[model samples]
Target: MERLQKVIAQAGVASRRKAEELITQGRVSVNGEVVTELGTKVTPRKDKVEVDGVPIDREEPVYFMLYKPTGVISSVKDDKGRKVVTDFIDSEQRLFPVGRLDYDTSGLLLLTNDGEFANQLMHPKYKVGKMYIAKVKGIPTRESLRQLERGIMLEDGKTAPARVKFVSGNKSQGTSIIEITIHEGKNRQVRRMFEAIGHPVLKLKREMYGFLNLKGLNSGEARELRPHEVKQLREIVEKNKCN
Candidate 1:
């Protein structure tokens, strides 16, 4: 027997933290009885689960890295029938994105049914850095660079200090290439950062997240993570478990 959230995660409903949310919201049922407490546990072989009225059960976990493309939403389903990240990967098991990539942006994204793994990576306390290559309008002045590096003021709050560099650019093209690395995962943050400084992003691609990168992968391609990579990720989570 395991904690209800753990069992729900093992079933690939969502991350463990998300599973807790579902439980508290009364979306989870075990053996026809609603369970709203995190301390609830069950024997998978004897108990049944229903999340949002759909039967759920434990299955072999799956993990993959997808090079998400523009026009594809980072969701399990879209009400408007738009293309989603799952459409790029063919798998029988249910998987959810660890984090999100905006519809207009493209690059490395992690998909998995392991809720604990997703929670560890996505939790802000870990301070995982995400790097992006952005093409934007005009060259950012030294003042603007300082603003970004020092922590730009956003509606939510001041952003954390970030790393920024000018990759290449010229006024003739009316665009410039710059790379920025940030720890915060605000919605459309890279684009909003540039737009905040009067330079709007023309294109954006995530280059790296923590140790994950897009190497030898084309747009819309999905590949399972290697055993060593999974081990390394678990180590990261365990190392920071106390913090």
Candidate 2:
């Protein structure tokens, strides 16, 4: 017998942490009875497990990298009928975005049916850096850029120090392009960071997540991750786990 949440995660219904929430919320059931305890365990072969009254089938995991387009939601489903990241890929397994990009933000996004892998990569303790390029409303001076590099205060709290690079600026247009790398995953963080420094982002695109990038794919396109790439990702997170 294995932990119920583990089985649920392996079945790709949700991440292990999310499975725990579903269990505690009384949304999971084992053998026709609702399970609310986190410690519940069962045999995947004998016990009939269900999430939201739907039986889950354990399918082999799949991973894909999407050059997500703007105006698309980074989710499996959107309540308002918006296009989602999963809609860009054709797959037999139920896949979900690793973390999230805002509805208007576009660029490299990872999707997978491996809940455990997704959970590990998204965990704050891993400290995976995401790099983004943004066109802001005003040119940021060296001191303002340095303030971002040294860490700045936001409504949520003070952000961690970031790697900020000034790309270019158009004095006449009153705009500048800046590249920044950050480890935090706060909602609308990139936009907020610039806004706090008096230069709100007018356009933004995520260029990298860890070492992954949108090399050959165009917007709205996706490709399966190579086995070696997946192995490298696992190694990266595992190595971080040891530190």
Candidate 3:
């Protein structure tokens, strides 16, 4: 048995906080009766939960790593009807993406039905790193690279420090591939980071998330994260919380 919000979030309908708002807004029901209290506990196997009259799915905990393809938005569904991350998924576990990749960006994206697991990974305090290889408009200068590595100012604020590697460029600065790793989860951060330095990203592909990377998978393909990989993820979360 678990709290109502946890069940709703694990069902992939919304995050735990949003689920609480649904409860407070008097939108959730249990066993055909309205349940607005946050303390409501449910035996998922026996209880029925409805959000706006639609039954929430109770599925086994599942995790997946997908090599997101270009032009696919990383989301459960797009109101505009554009192709989304789930369009690459072949499972029926009611999973949702842990984070997002822009419609034009590509590479490593995770989807899962485990809400707490998603929370641990997305939380900035966990310091989960995201690594990307970006093809930018031009190679950045030494000072610009230094600024990026230290932390650059964006309108949202100064970005967290980043780890970057690449050549300053020869004659192919316009086609330079810059490798960057950061622990921040700001919106379109990598693209914005490069743009701030006058070398706007022409293409961006995430290659790693924390210790997980897209090695065997290709664009648009996905695979279940091995048990050991999941264990590592849990460890990362636990270890960080302890500190």
Residue lDDT tens for model 3, 56-86 = 8877788999999998888888899998888
Residue pairs that clash (backbone atoms under 3 angstroms), model 3: none
Instruction: State the lDDT of candidate 1 residue by residue for 26-68, as single tens digits.
Output: 9999889888998998988888889988888677878899999
**What's model 3's overall lDDT?**
0.87
Q: For model 1, what is the error of residue 219's alpha carbon versus the real structure, in angstroms, after optimal superposition?
A: 1.2
Candidate 3 lDDT for residue 152: 89
Clashing pairs in 1: none
* Global CA lDDT computed for model 1: 0.88
Using TM-score as the measure, name the better of candidate 1 and candidate 2.
2
Comparison by lDDT, 1 against 3, better one = 1
RMSD values for the candidates in order, in angstroms, are 1.9, 1.5, 2.1
Q: Which ten residues in a row have the lowest lDDT in candidate 2?
A: 120-129
Candidate 2 residue runs with Cα over 4 Å from true position? none
Every model's TM-score:
0.91, 0.94, 0.89
Q: What lDDT would each prediction earn against the true structure?
A: 0.88, 0.93, 0.87
